[model samples]
Target: MPIIKLSVSERRRLQVFITCLLLAMAAWVLTTLSGAYHFTIKQVINFKNAPQRRAFKALQSDSVEVTMLGTGWQMLFSKVNTYNTPITVDLHTLEHSNYIALNTQIAQLNKTTDAKHRIVAFTPDTLYFDFTNRVVKKVKVEPVLDIKYQQQYEESGKIQVKPSYITINGPGNVIQNIKTWKTDTLRLTNVNDVVSTTLPLQPAKEGNISIYPKSVQLRIPVEEFTEKTLRIPVKLINNPHYYNVKVIPQYVSITFTVPLSRYTEVDEDFFEATADFSLWEQGYSVLPVNITRIPAYCRIVKTAPRNVDFLVRK
Candidate 1:
């Protein structure tokens, strides 16, 4: 290969030309970067400094737009870093105004991000809020649950909640409309025994509200049912002193349904069937056998010997 070389005088001239070209390029880049540009960014509005007796709610939304002017370098950083910092809207400073004056807030944001950037205009220009007195209400807390039981099994008792009610404090309008706080939905399937768990209460629709209790304990009693038969004696009670009375059937068969867990605990001893002489005044030769007492867990189906013949001796 053959190479062409330049003399010192020719090389010196070419070097100066190249240097000039590089200087012009650098100057243009700096001029363009230092120029001003407009940018629009969305910023979240954070409410703070609320007094104990007062509550605040934005009429439109919790966030707003922030339009500003900045140099190319500042704009580049803002784009990469996103909105500088969330605008902290002080509730205490909020007063009667068509739109919230964000001059102070935007200035702070600019100081933190880059003082070279200036806030020109807010897209919304302003903000409005509904301020109301803080009010508290006591509302019942109900557990939300979906449960499935095995065949022949059912809830034996009422669902029990540890804390029956909760106290909620918030804006008067919101608190007044609320009646009850519901727990997060709970689900249980194929349950044959008691079910117990703790569930968190659902959050309020309004973000500014406060709830005293956020959780509660729930209990559900479940039991399986079984048919049972208890043979109870029919006693002759309230007999006249001069006469002796005897019922034809000494015992009566009491058939009923009982919970499987309590089936063994229940027997004829837990039941009482009696034939009263007072019924004789109704002009009936036979006396009706009445079940005077039965276990609370038992459901009567049918009884044998509904009526019994009475023998009276004087």
Candidate 2:
């Protein structure tokens, strides 16, 4: 192959082009390395689950300062990009944990990457995070329990569950000196047969403690189906003294569906079934007879609403 050669003028032109390109590249490098622009170094603190997070009672330092090295473009975009969000380490989690310099964790935040992809680095070679023991406020723990009542019995009966307290896990200062959690009064009224329910646990008024399990299991003892009948005493209200009127029916049949535990509370003699004659004077042709004063745990299965009709002639 024949050798190729360049003329003098062509060579000179090529030299000038190379010189201009190198000078332009040098200027760009100097612009970045001048370090005239001010940059911010923000300490990053990361925390998960912001919604359910517990607030810190105290921290050694709220803010930290670091020297940043980067171009103007990198500094502006750094604000939008998160280096880290504040973290609240439960003091309890730190129990039996020592020789751990908190500053090491803070240093991780300083090396945070910039959003603008600038070749920037942080100064001081490390970050400082000062965390002090905080005074935390106490939160109440609410427990929920499920219960099933005995058969053939209404739910109006009272129940007792031993050791109704629960343990709460949280910051050390919060759970360290805590004990006992209570449940609210369970209200099951006039419910016959086996019943199942979840009871909410209530916490004592004191230090802040959050219960791990919001609900608890409640199993109520139930008795099999049983039938009982009693003769209830009848009482009358607003009897007319002017007219000789008698309560045609003196006794009413009282039946109840109750658990064996509550059977003793029922008193048939206490119940009074009566039709007020004054209602007739008030232009009432017929009075709707109803049973009053039934056992709290008992239900009226068969009630004699119109057991008897009285004939009164004045």
The models' CA-based lDDT, in order, is: 0.79, 0.51
Per-residue lDDT of model 1, residues 1-314, tens digit only: 43968889989999999999999999998899899999877777776665556666767776677787888777777777555667776555654432366665666556655566777767575666677888988899988888888988877767889788999988988888888899999988888888988889998667578887899889988888888887888987766664677788888898987888888888788899988887776788998888989876667889998999988866
Ten-residue stretch with the least lDDT total in model 2: 49-58
Which residue runs of candidate 2 sit more than 4 Å off their true CA positions?
Answer: 1-156, 161-221, 240-243, 260-267, 311-314
Assess candidate 1 and give its lDDT.
0.79
Worst ten in a row by lDDT for model 1: 90-99
Taking the candidates one at a time, how many backbone clashes does each contain? Answer: 3, 19
Off-target runs (Cα >4 Å) in candidate 1 are 1-49, 68-103, 106-122, 227-258, 264-314
User: For this target, which candidate reaches the highest TM-score against the unseen true structure?
Assistant: 1
How do the predictions measure up, each by TM-score? Answer: 0.52, 0.39
Give RMSD to native, each candidate: 11.4, 13.2
Task: Say which candidate scores most in lDDT.
Answer: 1
